[model samples]
Every structure is written in structure tokens, then in C-alpha cells.
Target: MRTKIILTATVLIGGAAFAIAQTSHTGHSDGMDHSAHQQEQAMTGAALSEPGQGAFAALSELVRVLEADPNTDWAQVDLAGLRAHLVDMDRLVMDAVVIETDLPDGISAIATGDADTIATLRRMVPAHAAQLARDDRWTVDATETNDGIELRVTSEIPAVVARIKGLGFFGLMASQDHHREHHFMMAQGKDAHGH
Candidate 1:
């Protein structure tokens, strides 16, 4: 069972990685050169950016190269940085919880909890979706509920669901409740201060 789960998770991660590859900005004829832009970013190392932007950018570039040539030299890739980024992602996942509902064609997951917890989900889900959107694997919609806010994530791919589930502390609460009542819990690695 564990092996099966790991295999499934691997497939999902690969699918999501492919989505990232497709969305990465390459040099296009529209006068927008992603390569040049990426270079600029590397040179500047801009601050005050989103939490995982740099890691996401690195993964995006790596995906782009791998897609272009599957046989590319592994030595050229930043394995350490990639590992660090994934660790960061795991940490973030460990700190949050998601309530999942199985829809007819897809899945709907809502982050439920206290005001601050909901707010954290509000911030993280879209940002995560935005990163995934670059790969075209997920679409995110938000609605204001009596509790706080609910994120409606829709994806046609089963791998997307699998990927979301693979995130730690995610998919803990599964319900058919489209009625929108918030029930929050503090996931592992989160303190009483909500940090």
C-alpha cells in the first residue's frame, strides 16, 4: 500500500511538473523573452517576492530544460536547490489542512478554520494555484462564505487531486458539505500563535 501510494504520488508530481514546464516562459516572438527575464532576476535576486517564487522559478526552468531534452545532463541541474524548495513546500503543507469533497468530475477542497487560519489558506491556496496555473493543471476560484472564504479548486486531471493529497496534513477532512461551514484545526508544525 505504501509503495502504491508513493508511485501514485510520483505520477501526480510528474504531471504537475509537466504542467509547470508547459507554463514556463520561453523566448517568444511577442518581444517578451523569458530567458532574458530570468537572467535579470538571477542577477538581481529581488527581495520582497512571494515565499516560494524563487524555488518555483528554479523548478520551472529545470522543467523547461528537461522537456526540451529528456537526456540532458543531470549535472547541469541544481539538485540541492530543488531539494530545498521541495522541503519548503513540505513544510508549508504540513502547516495547513484541507477539507476535500469529491465532485462528479473533479474535487472541491476548502480550507476551513478560524479567521486567521482561513485567511492563511486564502493567501496560500491562490498563490499555490498561481504557481500551478503556470503549468495549466489547476484553476482556482474564490467565494466568500459565512465562515470566511472558500477556495474552489477545479482540475480535470486525477493527478492534480493526487498531488494535492500528497501534501502533508492536506486532505484530512473529507466531506460532502457544499453548505460551507468552517471547521478548523491546527495542523502539525503549527504553533498556538498560528505561526
Candidate 2:
């Protein structure tokens, strides 16, 4: 009988403490609504959503697009190929060195780099030349060299000639708005940029 009475008293005290805690936290006793605290956290939380790097941001964007699309083939997804292409782009931009010479209308560039960079240039420059050739205003060509790649751009339009010369090799390489669509196509396992 004595043990049962002590157990009942302990249970009553515990329940009362729990009820008080609930009332205070729920804004019934302390008069501050916890809902406001939750709203503040939602408004000013320190958890950022950035991917924190360029290539990663690009990949994440592609992932989001793929996830949102019902027609995306999960089996055919080729993010690794896309990443390799991104690395090639990085090498071309960051590592390749170019010497420019005057052409009648535009410019010629002897683009050279380390072996890996040269390899990247070999893969990219000709493909870019093909893309530029599609424009009627410009003539573009790239040739493989023993050490690097040679690229020439010429245009009959005087203003365009000036622009092409101003752009030179790297800028011309970076030119055109086809990259995003090409990346999308590549992620979809399509022959974007002809490879």
C-alpha cells in the first residue's frame, strides 16, 4: 500500500511538470509564442543553399532540370561525360597560351599548352571552328600541330573583323551561346557539340 501511494504521487508530479512545460512553450503561460521563434528561424536561418563552386553549380542545375523532366531517361544520363567536357573547358581557358598574328580580315592564333592542355585544344578547337563556320559572316579553321593547334578566323565585314581580332583565340573560343543547350543535350546522352 505504501509503495503504491509513492508511485501515484510521482506520476502526478511528473504529469503536472509536463503540462506546465507544454503551457509555457505553447505561449499560454510565458506569453511569447514559439510560432514566432519558428518563423524567425525560417526567415534568418544560416543554412545556405549554394553549391559553392562553379562546376558543381552547373551540375546541380542540370540535376534539377533532369529531376523535373518526366521525359528524362535515368538510364541514359551521362553526367560523367558532361564533367569531362567541363574539365576540358577549364583546361582550355586556364592553361592554354596563344600568340596572335594579324590576318587580312581577322586573326590567326598559334595556341600552345602542356600536353594535357594541347589534347584539350585538339578536341575543342576544331569543333568550335565548325560551329563558327556555320556563320556566313566568318571563316574559321583549326589545324592540329605537332605541339599545339593553329586557328584562324577571317571575316569580310570590317566591324566584325575588328571584333574578331579583339576577341582573339580565347574569346572566340568562349563565344557563342550554345554551351547551355549543349550541356543539356550532353546530359541527355545526345551528341552535343558533335561528341
lDDT of 1 by residue, 1-195 (tens): 999999999999999999888767443555786567678888999643342565465455555655587665556444454444344444445554556676544456655565555555555455444444454565656555555445555567888766544432243222222111111111111121221
Residue 149 lDDT, candidate 2, scale 0-100: 96
Clashing pairs in 1: 19-135, 113-184
Off by over 4 Å in 2: 1-42, 45-50
TM-score of 1: 0.33
Per-residue lDDT of 7 in model 2? 100
Model 2 is weakest, by summed lDDT over 10 consecutive residues, at 46-55
Deviation from native of the Cα of residue 22 in model 2, angstroms: 35
**Structural similarity to truth (TM-score) of each candidate:** 0.33, 0.75
